[model samples]
Target: MFRFLPLPEGALCLIAATAFCAEYLLFYFHSTSHKGLEGYYHLILVLLIGLCVVSSVAGALLPTSFPVDLTNGIAITLQGLWFYQTAFSLYGPMMPDGCQLTGDQIACGSAASRVRGELLANFQLFSLVLGVLVAVVVSYGYAASRHGRS
Candidate 1:
């Protein structure tokens, strides 16, 4: 009954990107205020939504291009990791002690903590890129072997 469980790579990427876009939009609208660096979070969400839109369109239009497919995967993964980082840094348990939520604004008592957060985000992005690369290579190899092409 579930015939499309293994959707084509492009379709899967398109769906994932669309989902992330919807989620980010919802978060943007639900927020009570954007003060100080809070606005930056909203900006990140907007930027990610734009990236997802591009990735979705590219995935749909250039499904056969390995580079396009790889980009889509990387973009989607990055968006997810960024969402996690934003959530934890802004409202979750990972929030540093130097940061406090005042009304709608998150004030960091130490600039170093904020800088550390940014560096952590960079690390998250790098790790996701490596993971996506490995997954893509393995999937491509599997597909090739299954099709008896290599």
Candidate 2:
């Protein structure tokens, strides 16, 4: 990308996807610094970041596919929302009773409690996904109705 000149087609998309690569690596290596519930939540976030990477690449390859573009947007939205949820759970009162935020790390009373917290995080993720799906469908339907199109 010399002087950002004569960039190849989809170069911007690939560049955007590279940012997700960095995020994925950060979360993967973050296990050393983050523990227990915090690490688990970050792991889930990494999965979402991976999705974003895949969708962005797909968008680059299939530039005309509106669905792929929509998917990339949705994945990015989910990643951002998950970040907020992780912060709230790890740094706020939403944290499971057994876990405590100790000096920038989350420590659990026991392994069993940490597992329970992970399970709760799974539930939260599923709920967020379902809610977003519902919202998307409703928005699409409303737009279609108003425009008299499907």
Candidate 3:
């Protein structure tokens, strides 16, 4: 109902990117200590978000005749990435062949397990944020397109 924004695409992308930034800043940072690595990660993430916002705005500004197939493709790609990430986290350090803790290495292994758990939890949290952002963006885009028509 509030589809007055000129660049709904940019708005949606901004929302999603903001969620991603929050997740990476809050949860993922706890899993590592390498300042250099963190810097690199943040750099990559910022660039990615920047790209998304730019593309979204460009898409919105272009002629409506522009094909939406690319948007659909991106949505599909993100779904696949999210699924892959979720599957990877499901196999956290467990047993059989996971993070097998030997006798003397129990302490160190336990520590590793704790770290792994934190990582997985962060992953899940980020995944949730991403999912919500996607939903909001898609919904906003749909509403904006419909409103644009009338």
Candidate 4:
């Protein structure tokens, strides 16, 4: 809707929230058929997408809130990071032991290995989030020291 390009101020956030909401629904429902490690990863992704949806809506309500904006950014960042982690772990060289790419599906030889893979996925997502938060905090401190409110 190009006609609605210049949406009234905070309306932009609501629009973004709507988009994120639609994405979350698509992924959440579609993920039911994903199966195994793939399903678990998709579930994590869907949850993060839901977070983005919530944050965007919050941003609409609190347009000037820095924390709301930061939450939205971090959620989006984590979602993107998780996608990359999935690509590398499930489809790239980092595939867990006892798992193999058979045709187009990841086939783990045992339930334990699949569980291991899922835990690894969770750890990777957590690590990415921790790294981003640390970076943000460090940068904020640097900026505060040099250019923040005197």
Candidate 5:
């Protein structure tokens, strides 16, 4: 199935898989720690997983006419991936600021939040790498597809 798909499509699939693994591992470790406000972190992780799924599907369906207009399916999918990465990971640290939890709960919450931040940073890194790979693949695919035909 992937044989005919553009390189960007395959790369996005790999990126999505990588993101899911990171999310799952991060949550698994946090959950086992009996941390506070773990529910919120888990919720965010679930959202990331959803984003990954969307990216993979959209990339697969991206038209040959994409990388032309600004509203292409592939562009939308890439934007979604960027938004998810930036909003969730880089912004995760501030999401739990000034919590109402007290004592041990507060400590646990802060620690849990830090774990989330670390995970977010890692996710963003992977996203950035994936974005670059997608660009490269798309550029090459576009040029290759157009060569000798135009």
Candidate 6:
């Protein structure tokens, strides 16, 4: 069944990254404003989108090397986690105990809570990386075995 899909691994990664990029762009445009941390998030989102575009081109041009696939996997996972962080931190109940959303910006009541939120974001990124790594490895292994190369 999987044989019907003929895209190379890198191309697959690029497709996923592109999807995330589109979603991020939509969110960025729809948001109230880009100021303070919101601006920072928008900047990061733009950077991530650029990375995805470059990676996608590399993947299409050099499908044999796995570096593009790995990079895209990491970037896409980070983008996903970052989106979650932004959603929760700015608009959801996950806002830290001392933080309040103030007209498209987050105002933390204390530095401690802000630090905690940052720590949690780090942990989320780490967890997403781990999960993406495992999935990539497993998928690569399966593909290789199916092709009878390893």
lDDT of 4 by residue, 1-150 (tens): 748575665687898999998898898888888788888888888988988999999999998899999898988888888888888988899998888889877888999999998988878888998999998899889999999898
Expressed as tens digits, the lDDT of each residue in 1-150 for candidate 3 is: 445646544455445546555654553454353222223333334434444444454444552524443553354345345444434443333321223334422222354554554554455547655775688689779988988665
- Between 1 and 3, whose TM-score is larger? 1
Q: Could you tell me every candidate's TM-score relative to the true structure?
A: 0.60, 0.88, 0.32, 0.91, 0.32, 0.58
Per-residue CA lDDT of candidate 5, range 23-139, in tens?
Answer: 656655664654444444445455555555555545446534244322333444544565555454323443444343454343334676666655644565566658766886798
User: Number of clashing residue pairs in every model?
Assistant: 0, 0, 0, 0, 0, 1
Can you tell me which runs of candidate 6 are displaced by over 4 Å?
A: 1-47, 60-63, 142-147
In the order shown, what is each candidate's alpha-carbon RMSD? 5.1, 3.0, 10.4, 2.4, 10.2, 5.6
Q: How close is candidate 2 to the true structure, as a TM-score?
A: 0.88
The digit string of per-residue lDDT tens for model 6 on 1-150 reads: 458977655566567557756765775675447644445545555656666666766776677776866786567566666677667656887665666788757776776866665665556556666887788789888988899554
Q: What is the full ranking by TM-score, best candidate first?
A: 4, 2, 1, 6, 5, 3
Which structure is stronger by lDDT: 5 or 6?
6
Q: Tens-digit lDDT track for model 2 on 1-150?
A: 557598776677788999988988887787667667887898889899999999989888987787988899889989999999998898887998798888867899999999999999999999999988899889988988999644
The worst-scoring run of ten residues by lDDT in candidate 5 lies at 63-72
lDDT of 1 by residue, 1-150 (tens): 239486665676577667867876776775436644455665665666677778777877787887876776677677777777778767877665566777767887777866665565556556766887888789888988899543
Name the candidate that leads on TM-score: 4
TM-score, prediction 6? 0.58
Cα lDDT computed for each candidate against the true fold: 0.69, 0.87, 0.46, 0.88, 0.52, 0.66
Better of 1 and 4 by TM-score: 4
Off by over 4 Å in 1: 1-37, 60-66, 145-148
State in Å the error of residue 117, model 5: 18
Question: lDDT score, residue 80, model 1?
Answer: 76
